[model samples]
Each structure stands twice: as structure tokens, then as C-alpha cells.
Target: MISALNRLVDLVEDHLVEEVDVDGLAKALGTTEYHLRRMFSSLAGMPLSEYVRRRRMTLAAADVVRGGDDLLGIAVRHGYGSAEAFGRAFRAVHGAGPGDVRRDGGPLLAQPRLRFRLTVEGSTPMRTRLVDRPAFRLVGHAARVPLVHRGVNPHIQRHIAGLPPEEHVRLKALGDAEPAGLLQVCDDVDPDAREGSELTYLHGVAVSGDTPTPGDLDAIEAPEGTWAVFRTDGPYPDALQSTWAATATEWFPSNPWRLRPGPSVVAVLDRADDFGTATCELWLPVEPA
Candidate 1:
């Protein structure tokens, strides 16, 4: 994975003036574009598209300063058709227009090339299992919520709170599958997994496909697939969120599987009255790498 990501970085640098085909590059590296973009965003601390733009602008600023060509020509060479389009991109990255930078030679934000490396550590282990689940319905009060990477997501909390208390009881009773409780489900997530992206957040439960859903409740039809389940016990949401991050950082890199598009389900095994601490089982859909 590290080698592939480094090669991808090299490819980006080699084709800064050209339209790099990410899907083809990912295919050449023996990975999917979805996984590649997701991993790049996770490790690079920015979206792949954003990195590409910044890298292009970083180099374009040099030509603007050197005075070899006009702003329109430089912008067109960098894949922008017009000076207006290129100026917007240039100002976004360098905080100054190309014309101003051409005269003043000031204000440049450079995004350095990315490199990925691995460090072997045998200190901790991840608890995981492979589950082949049949098709099940996720039934509950659903909401559109922005994605949050760490700590608690207050939007999810408020969404669940807005549901009638009895609805929670009803959802729990409906669950008869592997994740046997009121499940916290996130579906139709953006492949890049960008923070603040809106995702289908279902405070729901898994049920058999034949199970009937109430018209008032939102439902997500989850198809049968292989799942990677991780179990954790600690402070509510904090430990769970850490485990989630570790899957991309530690677990997936070392494993022979890659994430697939599906609803991520979290089943609460136990929790305190105030929801400060608990045990949780996180189910993520995946396939052979």
C-alpha cells in the first residue's frame, strides 16, 4: 500500500501539466480508484483532488514569476481554459493573483510532494472478525448529517434524541440479525470520506428483508455481503472513533481486504446511563484486496 501510494504521488508530479487519469493509475497499481482516493485522503490529510490542484498551482506560480508566458497561456497549459478560471485557482492556493505575483513575486503556499512509509510495531492488536451477513433492512429514524472525524457527533445525538423514546424500543425489537440492537448506520458515504460531507445517517436497526417498515421511518436496503467486524470497549464515541481511524491507518494496510460501499453499522452491546462508556461492535463491508 505504501509503495502504491508513493508511485501515485510520483505519477501526479510527472503529469502536473496533463490530466492524470486516476482510475487508470489506480488500476495499474492493483487497487480501486475508490480505495486509492480514500487512502490518499486519509494519509495525505487532504482530498486527492485538492492536493492535485495545489500542486499544479505551486508549479504554475514559478512560471508566472519567471515571465516566460502570459497568464492565459500558463493557465491554459495547466488545463484551465481561461485566465479567469486559472486566476481563481491560483488565488485560492497562492493567496494572490497571477498578475500580482508576476510583478511582486510574493505570497505562495506550496504543497510539498507526498511520500508514504511504514513502521513495524508489534505493541497492540486489533480485534476483528469476518461476517457473511444476509440481506437485512435497516429501519429507524434517519437524518442527513455532516461527517465528523473525531469526538462525538452532536448532530447524530440530536437526531436520535428527536425520535420518540418508544421508537428506539421498537427498532430494537425489530432487530434479529448479527448486529442485534438499535444500530447506528451511516450509508451512502462519500468515497473520499471528506469531513462535512453529507451522509445518510440512520439511527436504525437491522431486520430481515421480509420485515415490513413503517411508512414514517426511513429505511436502507442493505444487500448481503462480507463484513469486517471490530469490537471495542471504552469511553463512548472516543474509543470507537479511534478504532475507526485505526482501520484505515493500521488494520487495512496490514490486511488482505479493502473497504466496499455499504452502510457502516455500529451495534451497542452495553452503555452507561449517561452514555459516557460502553461496548460497541462496528461492522464494515469489505472484499478481498
Candidate 2:
């Protein structure tokens, strides 16, 4: 994975003036674009697309400062068709317009090329189970919410709170499959997992695919797949969130499994009345790498 990401970085640099085909590159490297983008964002601290833009503007800044060509010529050379569009991108990346930089030879924000490397450390073993789940459907009240990596997501809390108390009980009764209780489900998530990205949040439960859903509820069709389930128990959200980050930073790097595209499910086996702590099972869809 480290080597693959480095090659992706190199590819970006090689084609700063043209569109880079990330899908083809990922396929050739024996990985899906979704997984590759997710891994890149996780380890590189930015989305692959964002990184490319920053690099492009970083290089374009040189030409702007050198005054070797007109703004239009420089813009076209860097794959932008017009000075207006290029200037917007430049300011987005460097906080200054190309024309301003050209006149002042001013400050520039440079995004250095990224390199991923592995360090040997396996001090603690991850508690996990591999399961082959048949097709299922998640049904519940769903909302579009922003991705939050730390602490409790107040939006999620609000979504749940808005549901009538009887609705929670009704949803629980409707569940009839593994993850056999009300579940916290996030689907259609951006592979980059960018903070503030919108995702489908289903405060719901799992049922066999053939099960009929209530007309009033939102439903997500989950195809059959292999799942890697990680179990954790500690402070509410903190421990669960850490385990999620660790899967990218520690578990996936060391294991033969790679994440596949699917909705991630969180099942709370136990918790406090105040929700200050929890015992959670996080289910991530995966396949052998």
C-alpha cells in the first residue's frame, strides 16, 4: 500500500499539466479506486484530488513568479482553459491570485509531494472476527450528515432525538438479522472520508434483504459480502473513533484484508444510560488483498 501510494504521487507529478487517470492506475495496481483514494486520504492527510490541485498550483506559482509567459499562457499550460478559472484555483491553494504573485513575488503555500512508509510495531493485537454475511437491508430514519472524526456527532444525536421514542422501539422490533438491534449505519460515504463531507446516516436496523420495509422508512440494499468486525469497549465515541482510525493506520496495514465499498455498521452491544461509555462492534466490509 505504501509503495502504491508513492507511485500515485509520482504519477500526479508526471502529469500536472494533464488529467491523470486515477481509476486506471488503481486498477493496474490491483486495487479499487475507492480503496486507493481512502488509503491515500487516510495516510496523506488530504484527498488525492486535493493533493493534485495543491501540487499543480505549487508548480504553476513558479511560472507565475518567473513571468516567463502571460497569465493566459500559463493557465492553459497548467490545464486551466482561462485565466479566471486558473486564478480561482491558485488562490484556493496559495491564498493569492496568480497576478498578485507575479507582481510581488510573494508568499506561496507549497504542498510537498507525499511519501508513505511503514514502521514495524505490533504491540497489541486487534480483536476482530471475519463473517460472510448474506444480503440484508437497513431500514430506518435516514438523514444527510457531515462526517465527524472525533467525539460525539451532535448532528447524529439530533437525528436520533427527533425520532419519537416509540419509533426506536418499532425499529428494534423490525430487525431480524445479525447486527440484530438498532444500528448506526453510514452509507454513500466519500471514500476520502473528508471532514464535513455529506453521508447518508441511517439510524436503523438490519433485516433480511427479502424483508419488506415500512413505506415510511428509508432503506439501503446491502449486497452479500465478507465483513471484518472489530470490537471495542471504553469511553463513548473516543474508543470507537480510535479503533476506526487504527484500522487504516494499523489493522489494514498488517492484515491481508482490504476495505471494499459498502456501508459501515456500528452495533452497540452495551452502553450507559447517559451514553458516556459503550461496548461496540464495528462492521466494515472487506475482501482478501
Candidate 3:
């Protein structure tokens, strides 16, 4: 996985002035674009597209400082059709427009080319299990929410809090399959998993395939697949969030499994009365790599 990411970075560098063929590169590397992008965003702490933009602007700054070609020529050379488009990208990265930088030879924010490396840190083993689940239904109240990488997402908190207490009980009672509890589900997520990207957040539970979903609830068809389930216990959200980050940094690199397209489900097995701590089972769809 580390080698594949490094190759992806190299591919980006080679094609900075053209569209990146992520799908083709992923296929050549025996991986999916979805998994590759997700892993890149997770481990690199930024989306692949964001990295590309930063890298492009970093180089463009040089041309802006060294005067010879007009802004349009420099923009065209860097793949932007017009100076306006290039200026937007340039200002986004360097916090100064191309014209301003050219006039002053001033501030520049450089995003160095990325290189991925694997570090040995398996001292604490993750508690995990593999489950082959048949087609099932996730039924519940769902809303579009922005993705949050760390800490408790207040949007999700507000969603659940808005539900009547009895709704929670009702959802729990309706859960008749594995991941047997009120589940926190994220579906239709962006491949890059970019922070603040909108995703379908379903506060729901798992039900058998044959079960009929209540008309009042939203239903997501979960296709049959193998799942990698990780167990975590500690402070509310913090511990669960840490385990999620480690999955990309440690587990996936070490395991033979890779992520597949599906909603990630979190089932809370236990929790404190004040909701300060929890024992959670995070279920992620996967396939043999």
C-alpha cells in the first residue's frame, strides 16, 4: 500500500500539466481508484486533488517570480485554460494571486512532493474480526452531513438528539441482524473522503434482507460482502476516531484486505451513562487484495 501511494505521487508529478489517470494507475497497481483515493486522503492528511493543486501552485510560484512569460502563458503551461482559473488555484494555495506575487516576489507556500513510508509500530494489536454478511437492509432516519475526521461531529449529535428517546429504543428493537444495535452509518461517501464533503449519515440499525423497512425510515441496501470489524473501547469518539485512523496507517498496509464500496457502520455495544465512554464495533466492507 505504501509503495502504491508513492507510485501515485510519482504519477501525479509526471502528469501535473495534464489530467491524472487515477483509474488506470489504480488498475495497473491492482487496486481500485476508490480505495486508493480514500487511503491517500486518510494517510496523507489531505485529499489527492488538494495535494495536486498545492504541488502545482508551488511550482507555478516559481514561474510567477521569474519574469519572462505572461501570466496567461504560465497558466496555459500549467494546464489551466485561462489566467483567471490559474489565479484562483494559485491564490488558494499561496494566499496571494499570481499578479501580486510577480509584483513583490513575496510570500509563497510550498507543498513538497509526498513520499509514503511504512513504519513498524505493531506493539498494540488491534482487536478485529472478519464477517461474511449476506445482503441486508439498513433502515433509519438519514440526513446529509459533512464528513468530520476527528472529534464528535455535532451534526450527528444534533441528528440523534433530535430523535425522540423512544425512537432509539424502536430502532434497537428493529435491529434483527449482526451489528445488532442502533448503528451510525455513513453511506454515499466521496471516494477521497475529503473533510466537509457531504455524505449520507444514517442513524439506523441492520435488518435481515427479507425484512420490510418501515415507510417512515430511509432504507439502504447493503450488498453481500466480507467486512472487517474493529473493536475499540475508551473515551467517547476519541478512541473510536483513533482506531479509524490506525486502520489506514497500520491495519490495511499489513492485512491482505482492501476497502470496497459500502457504508461504514458503527455499532455501540456498550457506553457510559453520560456517553463519555463506549465500546464500539466498526464494520467496514472489504475484499481480498
Per-residue accuracy of model 1 over 1-289 as CA lDDT, tens digit each: 7788888899999998787788898888778888888888887778888889999999898899999898899898898989999999999999999999999987888888888889785367889999998888888888999999888899998998898888778877877766888889999888778899999899988888988888988898888889999999899899898888788888889999988778999999999999899999999988888
Candidate 2 worst ten-residue window by lDDT: 117-126
TM-score of candidate 3 versus the correct structure, residues matched by position:
0.99
Candidates arranged by TM-score, highest first = 3, 2, 1
| Of candidates 3 and 1, the better by TM-score | 3
Give lDDT per model, in order.
0.87, 0.91, 0.94
- Give candidate 2's error at residue 129 in angstroms: 0.9
RMSD of 1: 1.7
Return the TM-score for candidate 1, rounded to 2 decimals. 0.93
Query: What stretches of model 2 exceed 4 Å from their correct place?
Result: none
Report the Cα lDDT for residue 48, model 3. 95
Q: 1 or 2, which is superior by lDDT?
A: 2
Task: Give me the displacement of residue 65 in model 3, in angstroms.
Answer: 0.5
List where candidate 3 sits over 4 angstroms from the true fold. Answer: none
lDDT (tens digit, per residue) of candidate 2 on 48-108: 8899899999889999999979999999999999999999999999898988898889779
The TM-scores, one per candidate, come to 0.93, 0.96, 0.99
